[model samples]
Target: LVTIVAVNQTGGDIPLSQLYAPNSKIPASGSANLTDYNRVEEILGDTSDLGRGATLEYHPDPNLLVAKTKDAPSATLDCSVGVVAGGTSDIPIAEEARIIAAESGLDVVRAYDVGVAGLHRLFPPLKEMILRDVDLLIVVAGMEGALPSVVKGLIDVPVIGVPTSVGYGYRGGESALIAMLNSCVPGLLVTNIDNGFGAAAAAYAICSRMMKKREE
Candidate 1:
């Protein structure tokens, strides 16, 4: 149900243009370029006898249609910020974080439910943010609260840690909050338990300050 039109970019004869005829890797014979031949028309001609559809439609190459390019913005008025969460329980936290971060003109990039137990899923998004030179990072973790510390150690950016109430117990999130506050990571900022919005606000403030300094 689809018709494909391809121009020979190799400066050679159309590879499979002649359907009924033998196909060859022949060189461009004359000055008649690949554009001079209509592949879609040739294909339609072969199936013309089976005629059901009355309309003939022509579509240009999609890449050509989308050829417009853009330059990166000159100012950090809308600064880039990264938000990551350790497990599925922290997804709502990440969303809250995203909303708060946006209030401070930060464009939030989320990596939700990146499993800390596996560690492999965690690294790629973190590596990407490092490559992008993100203004700040917000890490949300529940249970033992180890993920934020791990993330803080790996990246050069300032990290704000949010401890969520994911586990079951009398203490529950309190334990995670205590763990995060007492983290060995030298410069990690810890928020109260289940306080993703606070963590995001903290990161946003840092980013806003950095952006202002750049303007100065």
Candidate 2:
């Protein structure tokens, strides 16, 4: 049982006090704002009552949830890919890439905080990933943007470089993006600065083509 909470940004967290039945003083005819509606906890009871285990899926909007789930199964079997982030600051961009790939019906393996500053940290998993034959790789980095180049040198597979906007001072993210764009190695592709979603989309397209060729 997963409890998912979706709240309107403008409407603050609902207070516990306003959940009761309105009396004459409060006027039951008054508009009930979602902002005023406080805490909601779903109590999942034992499955014995219904002859099955309790697996309650709650959606804030029932119609949208139903439509989404109906298409989810068929949409989830398209591609297998890997996402490697250079550092902790790059995790958000990496996560965004993972989310985009997953939503596009791809399986994603996340390798995080393995930047080029610590060269030894990147080799083992990278070698293993290359051996396992991931269809495509998304290399996410910020500062120097050297991870993609290193990985490109190590493997023959296509690598898409993602430069995050996490650098400081005069260098800004432009320095990292330029570094990636200027990579001397071959088979290294690049997206705009901090464009994780775009990088993931490009990887998905590449994997999809590979899958199609495999099927043929």
lDDT for each residue of candidate 2 in 1-216, tens digit (9 for 90 to 100): 111212111122211123323110111222121111122231223223212122223233211111121112224445567899998888877876775565455777778888977888887888778777777789999887888998889888888999888856136578778888999999999998877757866876676666678779
All candidates: CA RMSD in angstroms?
Answer: 19.1, 13.1
Top candidate on TM-score is 2
Clashes of each: 0, 0
The CA-based lDDT of model 1 is what?
Answer: 0.59
Those runs of model 1 whose alpha carbons end farther than 4 Å from true positions after fitting are 1-78
lDDT per residue, candidate 1, 28-112, as tens digits? Answer: 2211111112344553354333233222322232111100012211122356889998888777767667654543346778897
TM-score of each: 0.62, 0.65
